[model samples]
Target: MNMNKKELPSLLLLPGLLCNERLWQNQVNNLVDICQPFVADFSQDDSIEAMARRVLDRAPEQFFLAGLSMGGYVAFEIMRQAPERVTRLALFDTMARLDEPERAATRKGLLRLAEEGRFIGVTPRLLPNLIHKDKLNTPVADEVMKMAAELGKEVFLKQQTAILNRSDSIPTLSKIKQPTIIVVGEDDKLTPPEESVNMAKAIPNAQLHRIPKCGHLPPLEYPQLTTELLRDWILQEA
Candidate 1:
């Protein structure tokens, strides 16, 4: 290991549903100069509490924590479970509330498809909901599909179950003492920018940013911008 690398702070990143380490590959590679980034494996757990516990068990004693979508749910659990260990918080394309009836129904329907062995991750019909319309034909869309396919059905099942059962985190937002940032894609249809707005308002001194023409998976959809945003957040004075 490089001696200087030891001096860098740890940055623990958690990915969303059907996403693996590949979801954060760009940020991991680009942010190496300022922080040691670690992507947690969220595939084994069937609940957010269990996922958060698994991450806390393996994460550094103290570190910066960031999560996207389903990962955001786990991040909230981590804060509740071990707030002292998190130096800062960053939420991307996620919300603090539990699923609405319509959303829950959609998730349940997808779960049924997977259970029936008909899981086709991130198909063309679903791409619009996950990314900006302009990116539908781009490599970014391909990467999203690739990630889903790579993680496959079992991981999807676990993630969906965890998300479905996650707690309502809005009430706990004001209690977060860490310097926090909430980011969302301007064109994000799933979580939407409004969700980030509500989170920013709830968390004390939290900063909110909306990336234009992007969607739920900003780290992959706009890697350079996402890297810069994270780099700035990591270096910002608390």
Candidate 2:
């Protein structure tokens, strides 16, 4: 789709767990000319499905959508509700299956920590798992920490609870007909490259791209690669 200067598609971006609007600022800066992007407030709703509905309610009549981690879960629900309204889709560092038993235990533990006012303790430990090991002591780490702090304990718990109970969407992926892009960080221990690969395989037309030397949050750690992949995917879809 070679859109003229004024014919760009609007994009709805979803942030991950314990994240805020800052996560997608780099993406917006990089794609503003080709896409008008809006960040979804997934923190407001308690359930993944409800959050998806709320986001879709405020989205353009039809638009391109991209989501990361927890956001991907909500995006899948949005796709389920309004497949026709979506012109293209992007899923990054996320999974299609619901939380597994071990993962649920992990989420439950995190929630318990949050409920006990130990959210700060959890953040330090959790943040490292979301970014590259080398970035653990850098400015990027500070930025992730800042975003998590900005999200606050109350909202973090809500996001975690919503994720714990999110529905399985693997079966629904194949039903989607829009152009799709699935990206993963080669070092992403949280979602893992295998999970993202499986999702790409399930979605008939999805293209999978893995970023090297990065972890779960590629937009923050490797903004240029993320933007390039997304821009290319958007151009291909058009």
Candidate 3:
């Protein structure tokens, strides 16, 4: 028993900053019967490299990997660290470049606010960027704020720091040889769809999918379609 692990199509999912297992709830529930699914813990780590290593240490010998936003950054780091272990890749609502100066400045401001215990400035205001404007008053909006609140300030700071420290992954985009898919929300203002286009263009044999009426958090904003895209991507190579 100690020498043998179960043989299954292991799908290891790494969630974005401030996102716990709840982030991949829909995918986890839907894919469990089809494969061995695992949601990674990134809250304890302050660096993307550490997060990648942690996932590698705990993941199956070889698995399909999907990550959203900051998790996408971690996914790139994973490829840089251990490309041999990732059988396929799905990058959703993410970019491969370093943050713009203004974006970095915004992150610093949020870090300062978190350090001063002023989380209110970050949520509702930051929430809109995470979802479509028309859904501003919906329960989905409330859920996003609630999740961030529960994750608290420390995790936020760690995540922000990790983003700040992330190098330009653009240089490595062409190197990914796995079965890759770049999915973005048509209305995603944060990472935007253009960046996803660029990623898909750079990666060999990578496919791009855009979720309609969706924003940055595609998995939660459009669960049904998100799950469908993932299922299709998984089956493409199977």
Candidate 4:
């Protein structure tokens, strides 16, 4: 390990459903100078509480925290569980609310498919909801699908169950005291920019950034831009 790396703050990154460290590969590689990046494994746990506990158990005493989509839900749980242990918070393409009726129905449908052993991760039909139209045929889409495929069906079932049963985090937003940043893609269909807008409004002193021509997965859709956003947030003064 580099001596400078040991001196930097640890950035604990949480990936969304059907995602792994690959989702944060760019951030981890690019932010090495400013922070030690650690991507939490959400594969073992089936509930947000358990997932948050897993992260807290492995996390440094005090670290910067960031989560995307389903990972954002776990971040909220982490804040609820150990806010004092966190130095900063960053949420990307996520919301503070529980699954709406329509969204719940969609998740249930997918869950049913997986249960019947018909799980096809990130299919061509679902690419539009997960990435920008321009990224549909690009390497970005391939990376997203690869992450989903590698995680496989069992992890998908666990992640979806956790997402479906996650708590409503709206009330917990105002209690966040750490310097926070909320980011969303302008064309994100899954969570939308408005969700990030509301989160920014709720968390005191939280900053919100909207990336144009992006979708649900900004870290993959716009890795450099995401890295820079995270760099600025991590380097922000007290």
Candidate that scores best on TM-score: 4
Question: Which pairs clash in the backbone of model 1?
Answer: none
lDDT of each: 0.92, 0.86, 0.86, 0.93
Better of 1 and 2 by TM-score: 1
Worst 10 residues of 4 by lDDT: 1-10
lDDT of 3 by residue, 67-167 (tens): 99999999999999999899899999999999889999998998998899886623667777888887788877777777777888888888889989987
Model 1 residue runs over 4 Å out of place are: 1-4
lDDT per residue for candidate 1 within 1-238, as digits (tens), equals 1234678999999999888898899999999889999999988999999999999888878899999999999999999999999999999999999989999999999999999999999898999999989899899889889989998999999889888989999999999989999999999999989999999999999999999999899998999989999999999999
Worst 10 residues of 3 by lDDT: 1-10
- Could you tell me how far off, in angstroms, the CA of residue 186 lies in candidate 4 after the best superposition? 0.3
TM for every model, in the order presented, reads 0.97, 0.94, 0.94, 0.97
- In order of listing, the candidates' clash counts read 0, 1, 0, 0
Error (Å) of candidate 2 at residue 147 is 0.7
lDDT digits (tens) for residues 76-139 of candidate 2 = 9998899889999999999999877997998899889889988883356776688988888787
How many residue pairs of model 1 clash at the backbone?
A: 0
Give lDDT tens digits, candidate 4, residues 24-97: 99999999888889999999989999999999888888899999999999999999999999999999999999
